[model samples]
Each structure stands twice: as C-alpha cells, then as structure tokens.
Target: MAQDPPVSDLTDDQAALELQRLALVLSQANQAYHRDDSPSIDDASYDQLKRRNAQIEQRFPHLKRSDSPSDQVGAKPKEGFGKIRHRQPMLSLANAFEVQEVEDFVARLKKFLNLAPQSHMRMTAEPKIDGLSLSIRYEKGQLIHAVTRGDGETGEEVTANALTIADIPKTLSGAPDVLEVRGEVYMTHADFAALNATQEQAGQKPFSNPRNAAAGSLRQLDAQVTKARPLLFFAYAWGDLSEPLAPSQSEAVARLQALGFSTNPLFITCDTPEELVSHYGAVELARSDLGYDIDGMVYKVDDLALQARLGFRATTPRWAIAHKFPAELAWTELLGIDIQVGRTGALSPVARLNPVTVGGVVVSNATLHNEDYIAGRDSKGDSIRGGKDIRVGDWVQIYRAGDVIPKIADVDLSRRPVDSAPFDFAEKLKQEGIEGKRAPGDAVWRYCGDEPLADLAIEALKHFVSRQAFDIEGLGAKQIEQFYHRGWIRTPVDIFTLKSRFGPGQLQQLCNLDGWGEKSAQKLFDGIDAKRSIELHRLIFALGIRHVGEGAAKLLANRFVTWEALSEAMQSAAPGSAAAAALVEIEGVGEVMAQSVVEPFQDPERFAALQLLLAQLQVSPAPQIDSSTSPVAGKTVVFTGTLTQMTRAEAKARAETLGAKVSGSVSAKTDILVAGAGAGSKAKKATQLGIETLDEEGWIALIEGL
Candidate 1:
C-alpha cells in the first residue's frame, strides 16, 4: 500500500497521479465487493479511500479521471443474472467519522435551506446495514421484480432468489400502483454461524462474514440454493414511488412496515445533533446484541420536502450522511522509511511496517507526512507525539481511517530497539541522488535541476487534454507521450498545428507512422480540429498553470467573460495596480494564485507563445448566467459584518445563483454593499464611494420573492 498526501498538500502532478491510482485501486475493490461478494478491503477503508479521492477531485477538479471512482456507485452486475435498469438511481451516502463531522452535516443542511440555527428540523437515524442493497418493485399490490443495486443505474434481476426471503412482502393490501421498496438483504449472526457449520460439514468453503454470506446466497444462480440459505430484508427507503410514501422519512419507514415489510425496530427521529450523536452511541452499544450486521448509523433529513430541497451531489445525497464508527488501530514494528518522488519532483516519505491487521485489512505501509513529522514536530516547530522522535526499529501504532492507506498514529517508545538511531532523512535523500532544496515556507523538496524533465512536460500535455480541460477525443495520453518523445509535439501550441504539419505528403507524416493509418490519422486530426473553438474556462485550464485548476479557471473566465479581456488584464496587472487588485479580489483567488496567473503574461517569451497559441483557434466567452428575474444581476455585491439571516457561504452562493459577482473587497467599481450587524471598513468604503448600501433585512426583502 502507498501512502498519499492530504489533498491540500498535493501538487498538480501529484494530484493527477493520485487520481489515476485511486481509479485503478477503487475499481478493483468495487469488483471484489459487488461482483465477487468478497470485499478486498473493509468498509471503513473503502469509505476512506472514496473520501480521499473526492477531496483530491474537489481540489483539482480539472485532473479528475473520466473513470473516476467518485462518480461510480457499485461494480457492474455479475453475469448469469437477468439485467434490470433501476427506475431511480440508488446512490451511496457520504460518511462522517467524527462527532464534529455529524454536526457539520446538520449545519450544512440548515445553511442550504437558509434556515435559522434555532429552527426546528428533524432527522431520522437508522442503522446502516452491512449487506447488499436490493430494490423490490410492487405493481398493483403484487410483487413485480427484485433487483440488486448494481452500479446505481442498473442491477441484476434476482426476483426468484429474493422471493425466498420471508421478510420481503409478496403482496400489499393498499400499495401504490408502482412502488419500489429499497432495503438491505442481510443474514443474522446465528443463521450465518449455522450456515458456516453446515458448509464445513459438507466440505464447502465457509463464508467470511454475515454480509458476504447474505450477498452470496441472494446472488446464487440456482433458486433452490438461495431458498436453502437464510436471508432477511429490512426496508428503510424507497425508489420510483408512484405516490408519496409519507411526508417524513420516519413515517415512510412506518408506511413500509405497515405494508408487511420488515423494518429496523431501532429507527428513531431526532431534532438536534446532540440527539443524533446520542442515538449513534446507543446504536454502537447495541451493535453486538443485534442479530444482523450494521456498519454505522445513517442520518437523513426527516422532512421529505427538505430532503427534496437539499437534493443530491454527484454521487451522494446532500440531505443524508452516514456516521461511521471510529477506525481500528494496531501496533506494528517500523521496518524502514522509503522516499517516493512524484511527477512534480516532490519527495514523499512512506513508512514501511511489519504487516499487521487493523480492523479487517492487513496494513504494511503508512504515511509519515514529512521530515518534520519524523522529527516529532509540525511545520511550525510545534512539538507533536510528546516530542518523541520516530526511529526505524520502533514499534509504531497504525490506524486505518479510510483505507486508501493507513497512517502512523503513535510510536511505542518502550518497545523501541536499543540499536536503532534517529532516521537521517536528509542523508537518505542525498543517498537516493535527490539534491533538491526545500523552498522557504514550503514543506516539499522539489527538484530544482537546470534541465527540464521530460516527465513534467509530458504530464502537462496529458493534463491539457484531460477530461475537464480541452478534452480532445482520440488524442489521449499515450498519443501525446508518443508524439512528445518523437519531437513532433513539444507544447500545447504544437497540438493545434499537428494536422497541418503532418496531414499528407509531408516528411514524417502521421499516416506513415506505425499504429497510424489514413483513417486513424484523420480521426486524430478531426479530434484536434474540433477543439479549435474552445470554451474560455477549458482553454484557461488547458494552459496548466499552477493553482489554476478547473474551478479556478472557471472563476477566472466568469470574472473576465472573454479571453481577450483576461489576456489584457493579465498583461497589465502590475504590482499595486487596479488590475492586480481586481485579480486578487475574485473569490477563491489569493496572492500566490494571482501571481501564478500573471507570471506567464509578464514574461515576453511566454506571452509570445500564448499569443501564437491563441492565434491558432477561437476562444469562446464564459457561459451566460440566466438572471432575467434577479434583482442583482451583473452587479458587484459585497457582504460585511455579522450576518443574521444566513451564513457568509450561503449568502455568497445565493448571490452567485442570482448572477451577482461577489467580490471580497470594495473598490471604485463596486455597485452594491450588503451590510449586516457590526459592519466594517468595506461598508464605510462603499458609503464613501457613493455605492448603493443595504442592510441585511433590505437585501433579503429585495430578493425575497425571487
């Protein structure tokens, strides 16, 4: 296992590598769990990996893979089972490992709904069953079909196997014309133990866990084999309901129970985070006593209307979250430390440990963070781990939070080897032929060699055509690398001129190259030609500037509107100038990022290259915001002081949704200022500038109807 740096700590090249690694690793894990009914990693590790992957994608949205794990739900349905398309997609829940995260979840819900802190909001907390999710459809009060939650949108039709579960209702007295009941199919501990005993007596391989036993039995090809296995269902949610089940989630579960379907008895409603956390603790206490397996407690907004308003993200519902149990920890001997260099030339330290089982997965590698961490200090020289440095032969405690990789928690000084000495991190780097110097205020040691690395250039080219960038079809990473090595393409500018350079009757023509025919070469040319008229955001991101990812590029495009405007602004954004101020005033752009954006334009050589690149194609302006009914459309608004109606984030988001540009600072160009309680300098500046000023209530009233 490889240790990964925090998303915030990763460089652009490192983030790209991490995305690739996660895509492959998560794909394998999904196959093992959904297809084979034998998970390669525990649920905690899987959730952690998913969480990390999502964090990285959120940080570097441009580098997100086309086959990103964040977008996938489950593995494809296994063969031999009739395929069924789910009427509604069955999404997974975001996870919360700490009480603070649960609180944050509640806070986010209130913020999204623009509700007061003291407002009454109920949430239902129920056990997250550790088994396979199944959707059973009932049409006209009769059972129609039963489908597994395969890849969210489609599933395996296991109607015959599902009918054997006594907990599932075959007929309903007063059900809707179309009712799709979704729940978990699980096996009780007692039944699983008995089944395992039977399997041993019959010389068959016993199942690993109750959840695996249930999934394997439910997915069995032979209906008789499934009938003989003990499987139970608990209905907690619904899909494709012709009529609403109930106004609230708790009521909906009750409605399912009334329909003769088995439901969890401990499901309860709570009004606050305290109550929710209390219920989660109670559930954890009762986990061992419960007959079936449950990984954690799931919290969902009780009011169905609120849930609908909250809606969903790419893969998880914004109205719900799973409060997972704490990570498991184990002690293992620290074997050695290895330094791995990323494509960005950043050196990362990984800890090798004697294989030990934490939770259910074997862990041999952990992240040491950096040299400072090994010296028992943080970047600020603050003492950590009681100022006890880690040694090579010490017994270290490792914990698996989300299983992308385990992390070292603590060092066991008492069990440290007498012969072991403090690890020489600097000497190790020198020994590995790494002679890079760490920049001031930067933790990472980057390669500062005079010559440019081929890997960096190739990675930049790959990023230019990444899914969220130019997204050139047929011209992928492999093609880009091959062309780069052959000296056919050196930079992004060369890609646009490729067709003209090697279309036909030219020395070293693309059609004459191996793996390239007339049709294939023409297809590649067409793909390149299609990107001649590109979106402003895509073109900006395709430039591959540091700190300018998809989100940042979109922000830049939205602010400037057109490529010519941005180009002119960047060229004239001198130090302390209005243009420079405006550049930093854009929300999410800081001094460092602004400098990165301005550096290329400031250099004559780079600016000349950019000009040449722009000359080869047409750059479209940013997408128009449909703010026909917005009172603040095309206006620059600033919020200062204490907001009573909503948080600053909500206010900003609302303003943006209404087509208003929310700037961080007030300037001569400022159109309006929304002042709240304890209004500060920005409000004063707005008043001095003779700009429109509105109190919180006034601002709210202005946009209330819309």
Candidate 2:
C-alpha cells in the first residue's frame, strides 16, 4: 500500500490539483450512497476523503471550489421511488469525530443557551443505527403514508413497504391527530444473515451490507418482497405534530413508546456531558452484542424549548450532533491534483488518488483545501506534516469515518518520488485576470476573477427566479443561463420585457433553439408573463440583497407593509439616522443586516435596476388578515412575557392565521394584550391605557370560538 502525502510535502500547485480531484470523487461517492445505496467506497474511506477535503479547503481557503463536497447534503433522490416532499425537511446531523469534538459540541450547546459552566444541562443519547431512514406519517391516529429521507427536502414514498413492517403501528391509541414518526427501518443481524443465505441459495446477488439489505428491502417495488424480509422500525423521533406529546426530548421518546411504536431502549437521559460520553463508550463496547447495527451515538439537548431556541443551520440542527467512532485508515498513491471554479469564484483543489480500499470502500479522490494547506502549513501558519508539503506521485495516508469524505492523514516520506515538484495554482491557470486573494476574515486564497460583478450576475438571476423568489415556472437554471448568454435576460426587468420587445419573432427564434419546441417556447413566455404580479416579500428576496434572506425579507415587508414604503425608507435612511434605526427595529433585523439592506439601495446602478423592475411589474402589499366575525379579527394583539402553551413564534403564527394582527409594542392601537407570566412594562402600559389584557387561559378562551 502506498503512503499518503503530507500537506507540508506538497507545493501550492499540487494541493490545488488534489482538491479538485477530491471534489469529483466525493461527489460520485455521495451519489452512489444516497441514490444507488451501493457505495463504491466504505464509510472509513469516505470520511477520510471528507476530512482531507476539509483540511485542504481550510489551508487553501481562497481556492475553494464551488462544487466542494462540503457544501452539499445527501445525494439526489432516485426516480424509481415516488417523490414525497417533507412538511419539515429531514435534515442530517453534524458529526463529531473525536472525544474532544463531542465535548466541544456540548460546550457549544451550553454557550448557545447561555448556561453557566456548571449548569445541569440534560441531554439524550441514542445509538445512531445504520439503516434506512423512514418517515411514517399518521393522520387521525392512523398510518397515512411512509417515505424515505432522500435529500432532506424530498423523499421517495414507500407506504406499501412500510406497512409490511411489524414494529410500525398501523394506528395509534393516544397519539396526536397529525403525527410524523421518523425512525430507522432495519433488519436484525440474524435476519440479515438468513436472508443473505437464502439469496445465495437462490443464486441471486446478495446485499453488500446490512444497511443496504434493509434499504433495498424497504424500497422494493413489490410489497410482497418487502414482507418476506424481516424488517423492523425503531421510532426515535417525531415530526410535524399537531399537538405536543411531551416537553422534553427524553419524554417525547417515552411518548413514542407509549403510542405502540418500538423505541430504542438503549437511549438514556443524562444530565451532564460526562454521562453522555460515558454512555457512548459503553454503547460502543456493547456494539457486538446489539441485535442491530449502529454506526455511532447521537446526543441531543433534552429540553425541547432550548432546542427550539438553538434553531438550525442550513442542513443540520444546532441541538444535536452525531459522535462517530474512530475512523479507519489506508494508504494510496497520489496520482494527480485538479481545480474547479465555484459560484462565488473560488478555485478549489482536489486530489486524485490511485484506487485503494479503506474501511470497505474504494477512495479515488480527496480535497486539498487551498494554497497554505498544500504548502504543509495550517491556515494559521502552524507547521503540518512537520512542515512537509504533499506532491504528486507521493504515497499518502487516508482515513474515513461514517459517510464523511476521505482525508489525507499524512504522507510517508520514505515513499515520496524524488523527482516530484511543488504545485503553483496561478501558473496552472495561466490567466493574468485570475489572481489569488483571500476574502475578508478568510484564511483561504481564492482565485478571484477581475470582474466579480459580472460573475455574480448569473448566480443572482438564478436566485431571482427560484421558487421562493419570482417563482417563474419553466424558467430553470439552464434556460436562464442560455438566455443570459444570448443577451435576452441580463437583468430581472429583461425577463418581464422578453415578449414585448422580442415578441413572436424571438419566440420563433427560441423555438428554433436546440432544446425548445413551439410548446416549450410558449410555455417559457407564459411563465415570464404569469410573474407580472408578485408578493412583496418574494420581490424583496428576489433582489438578492446581501444578508436579506427569505425570513429577513418577510420581516422587512411586514414592517413596511408596501414595496414603495420600504424603497422610500431605504432611499432616505442614511447610516446611523433615525430611518436606519427604524429599519433595525424591525424584528430579526440587526445592524449588519440593516446595513446589508441599505447599502444595495445606496448603489445607483442597483437602485436604477430596482426602479426598472418595479416599472415592469405590480408588487403586492404584505399579508393582511380580516375576519369580520371573530372578535380579535383585524384587532391588533400584543403578546408579552413568556408563552406557556406554545412558543411566542407559534402564538404569533396562530394569531395571524386567525386574521389577527400581531404587534410588538403595547399602545392605544393594541386592542388586546395576551399577557403570560412575568409581564412587565408592556402589561402595565396596556392596563394604563385600559387595553383589554388577558392571561394565557383568557387569551385561549377569546380565540376558541374564532
């Protein structure tokens, strides 16, 4: 086996090349695992690749590729399974590879909740079983459907196969009217062995692993085939609940048990991080004895309220993390390095490795991060590989943990080829316009183009027409790219004017395009025409202002009520002015976000673009609910202090649904004040103004009829 090259051993050019290769290989592996369920590489190999990819990315931060594996989630869903969109995305958990990382996870959670160092924070630890993820939804206490966790947002419907499992409950005795029980569908070791034996006897291809066997069985087209397989479900979590089952994570698991579903018994509640880690060790020790397979232990914050406050990242929850066991390592030869450009103009490097198996999977690539990583120094300039740089043709050590990308651990000095040289990314690209530079506060060296604004135009347009934005159907990324290249859709306004300026002549030209027919061309024009009118929040989001995400845009829209009002405010709001303060006062808007919202409007070119866009469309005002029959309908309600029955956000959402206007302040306009415990000056002001004040119970009573 060839040894892995150390970062110190490689030059900048070599590192960039390695990162590029790693990106391609990891992407392929992810697809194989998520879509095909037949991973070409083992868990250990994949982890090593990912770790190496991350390492290189960190070292050469500027050269990070757009298609860097770190940015992606699970693979795309297969077409065979009927696509079912999840009500709430089924997100993946962040991983903690080391004991220290687990400790850091706990510490981070504690800090997020503003807990004292000695705070008796409780956590629930459970075995992360290696099986197919299943979501069984129940309506009116009866099983309605089941689906696979495809790419978090959408999954394949496997209702029939799920019904065949004995451990899944067909009907719940005392469950919420609407419940989504998410868990793993797995076959026991004994059953898997027997099934494989039977398959071998029948001269059929046996499953590669227990996880594969379970996934394949549950995803079978014929329900009878799934029934023949001894599959069992261990309900571990609940989603999209109509009502609360319990207040904490541990109690929720108990509720799942009481509701006639099989819950994992090994999961235990611990008040401290020590206990969680200790329990993890015990579980790891007993892995051989467990009936089913578990790759690692998962630790989640016990308090549901805290979990809610911690919220979520782009793809993982802040309250939970999976602590994977030690990864396996193998050696492979460094064949070459490559680079690829990202949407943000970062040039990322990847490693192409000679085929080598590690932890049951073959790894052919890994990530090399950026300039410094390939130079054998940490992002902070600390010596790595004893200050040795990795070079092409050198042997390298690779490691993998779970489904993470494989990483190069170190290079074996003895096996490095004598004639190998350092890599220079700038020289490789050979373009004066493409220069390497670091982003603000970023340690990586990105290969930035001279004209970043032009590069940003294409990505900006893509976001502008996305579902959450303009939602122009039939105008997908490919179509937008083509139109941009053809000078037909350079800006948002161009999309609206396509028919008026170009008309049938352009439509005929579009029809003559390779991928377009008469029907498709008409459909494209119709899509553009249908979006002549748009909601205020969507329009604000479509502008793609920095830090102005969907949520932030909604807040701005609701606060201002109309596009004209917001544009006027932004136009007049000088930095540190009262207008700027008002913009910041809106819920969820802070100084940074307020500045991001303002700076774009200050730009003459962007402001003109906005004007042109407005001239070509009719933007609607923010949502207004009016229910004439309801007492609180159209009435301004202010919720103060802690809400006992539900979260404050939930209360506000419910109130809005009932056609009531929820306000942040208590004043003469506040018709009703829903005061919970510990109500302060707002409650006093409401009382002073003779505004109707109601406790949690009273408020519930008032809304009961409505």
For model 1, residues 1-706, the per-residue Cα lDDT tens digits are 2455556877775576566657766898998999899888877677877888888899999998899998888999999999999988999888899999999889988989999977868999999888999999999999999999999989999999999999998899888899999999998877988998777533245787788899999999999999999899999999998999889999989999998999998899999999999999997766656777777899999999999999999889999999987666688898889886544566678999898765444568888888888999999999998898988999998886533478888888889888888888778878877667788888776667776667667888888888798888777777787789988898889999876776346534666666667677778788889999999989999888877877788778877889999999999999999999999977678899999999989999889999999998899998655687788988999988656556675577568867888888999888888876446577768878999988766788887767
- TM-score per candidate, chains pooled: 0.50, 0.47
RMSD of each: 15.7, 18.5
Instruction: Please give the range of 10 consecutive residues that has the lowest summed lDDT in model 1.
Output: 502-511
Misplaced by over 4 Å in model 2 are 1-16, 59-61, 327-706
Against the correct fold, how does model 1 do in TM-score?
0.50
